[model samples]
Target: MEQANQNQDYQAGDIVYVFYRNPHTQDVANIQAAAVVNHPEKENELALFLYETYYPLSDEVAIYSTEEEANQAYHYYYGEATEGVLE
Candidate 1:
C-alpha cells in the first residue's frame, strides 16, 4: 500500500505498513518498516525492512534487510497477496 504525507508522495524515512497474506493460511500480516531509498531497478518497489524487536526469546524476531525479504516474510506469514497503506 502507498500513502502520502502532507500531500506529498511516499519517500525514504517515511514509516509504512506492508500487509500480505499467509502462504499457508488465508491470513494477513501487517509489518512495519522504513523506506530505505528509491530503487532504480524497481520503480514501484522500495527498500524497506524491520529490525528485530527487543525480546527475551530463544530466537530473534524477524528482520527483513530488504523489501523483497520483508515481502516474502509477509507472504509466508499470510496466505495470500496483501496490500498496505499508512496506518
Candidate 2:
C-alpha cells in the first residue's frame, strides 16, 4: 500500500536524476536526467524513458527516490554536487 502510494505520487514529466559510473575505468561516468514516464508494470517501480546518453545502456539505472538522494549519490561518485539539471 505504501509502495503503491509512492508510485502514484510520481507521474509523467517528473524528473529523476540517475548517477552512474564507468565499468572499465571505475570513474564517474555521467549524471543523467531520467524523466519519469509512468509506473512500471511491476509494482513499486518507477519507469524512466528519457536520459542523457553518455555510455552504452547497461542494467545500472542508479535511480534515486529524490533530488537529495540523487545529489548525494552524485557527490559520492564524483566528489561534487551536481551543477544543473540536464535538458
Candidate 3:
C-alpha cells in the first residue's frame, strides 16, 4: 500500500534523481538522473529509466525529487559506503 502511494508521486514522464554505483566498479558511485516510466513488461508497474535500463521503482532504491536532494544524500551515503575504498 505504501509503495503504491509512493509510486504515484511520479508520472510516466517525470524525472527523478537517484544514487547509482558503477556495476563494474563498486568503488565508483554518484547520483544519476532517471525517468519514471511504466514498466515495459509489467502491467501497472512503475520503473526507472536509467543508463538504458529499467529498474523497478521501489523503496530499495534511493530516489530524490531533485538534484540537490540527490547530492545531499550522495554525500551522506557515499561516505559510509566507501569507507573501505581507499582513494
Candidate 4:
C-alpha cells in the first residue's frame, strides 16, 4: 500500500472518489475512482487522474482536503453519498 507523503496527507497509491461535472450542462454526471499519482509542485496539492472513462466529456474537477468534504459535496451536487481525498 502507498503511504501518505509528508507534503500532503495522501499516499501515492491511495484511492479517492472524484465527482465529475459537465462543463456545459454544469451537472454532475457520476462519481469516479482516482488514485493519488503524486503531489504537484504547488503546496498542498494532490494530482489525480480519472480511473474510468465514461461520458468522455470534459469535467470540472474539485479537489477537497478530506474525504468527508468530498462526500458532502458529492451529496450536495448529485444527491449521492461518495468520497475523495485531498491535501
Candidate 5:
C-alpha cells in the first residue's frame, strides 16, 4: 500500500506510478509508470526511472504503487489540468 504521502522506501527494480507533468506542455500532466532502480550516483539509495531520466528517490518526490492511487492524487493536486511545467 504505497500511497503518495507514505514516503515508503521502494526496492530496486520495483515498478511504480507517478503523476508526471509534460516538460514541453507544462500545464498538462498524466500518470506515468516508473521504475525503482539503484541510484547511479549514490550509495544505498534508490532512484526513479521515468522519461529516460533517473530521479533521486526521496520524500520530495511522490510515488504510488498503483495507477488508481496515482490518478487519485493527480486529481487532488492538479484537478483537471491547467498549466505548470516540470523542473
Candidate 6:
C-alpha cells in the first residue's frame, strides 16, 4: 500500500517503518529502522529492511537514535502523541 509507493523515492539510511507479523502468533509488529535493504517491486512496497534493534514498543513508545532527534521531529505533530518532550 502506502509503504511500497512512498519508498520508491527514499534512499538508504532514510527512516522507515516495516509492517510485519510475528511468526508464532501472527501478531502485528510495527518496526522502524534505517533503510538498509531495498526491494523495488511494487508488492514489496518498502525499499528497506528494518534493523531489529531500533524497533519500538508500548513502554518504549517513542524511539530514535537520540532523544533530541525524536523530540525535534514528532514532539508537536499530533495531540495524543504529544507527551514527554511536548509536555
Best candidate, lDDT-wise?
5
lDDT scores in order: 0.44, 0.52, 0.74, 0.51, 0.76, 0.39
Taking the tens digit of each residue's C-alpha lDDT, what string does model 4 give over 5-74?
A: 2344565667666665556666435555667664445454456757443221113445444466566666
Whichever of 3 and 4 has more lDDT, that candidate is 3
Report how far residue 52 has shifted in candidate 1, in Å: 15
Model 5 CA lDDT for position 32: 80
- Local error of candidate 3 at 27, Å? 1.5
lDDT of 6 by residue, 1-87 (tens): 111332135444666433333466563333334443345444433333444432322222333443445444443442234333423
Higher-lDDT candidate of 1 and 2: 2
Clashes of 1: 8
Task: Count residue pairs with overlapping backbones in model 4.
Answer: 0
State residue 49's C-alpha deviation in candidate 2, in Å.
1.5
TM-scores of the models, in the given order?
Answer: 0.33, 0.44, 0.78, 0.43, 0.78, 0.33
Better of 5 and 6 by TM-score: 5
Indicate the residue-level lDDT of 9 in model 4.
58
lDDT for model 1, on a 0 to 1 scale?
A: 0.44
Better of 2 and 6 by TM-score: 2
Tens digit per residue, CA lDDT, model 3, 1-87:
011124447789989887688899987877778999999999998899999999999988878787766666666655656422323
* Stretches > 4 Å off in candidate 1: 1-28, 34-58, 84-87
| Candidate 3 regions with alpha-carbon error over 4 angstroms | 1-8, 79-87
Cα error, candidate 2, residue 12 (Å): 1.9
lDDT minimum window of 10 residues, candidate 4: 51-60
- Candidates' RMSD to native: 13.1, 7.4, 5.8, 9.5, 4.9, 9.9
Task: List, residue by residue over 5-85, the lDDT tens digit for candidate 2.
Answer: 232355567765665455676644666566775455546455666533232222445665566666666666557544522
* Candidate 3: C-alpha RMSD after superposition: 5.8
| Model 1 C-alpha lDDT per residue in residues 1-87, reported as the tens digit of each score | 222222334455555444333457664456565444555455655444335322111112343444665666566654465563223
For model 6, the stretches where C-alpha displacement exceeds 4 angstroms are: 1-4, 38-47, 51-87
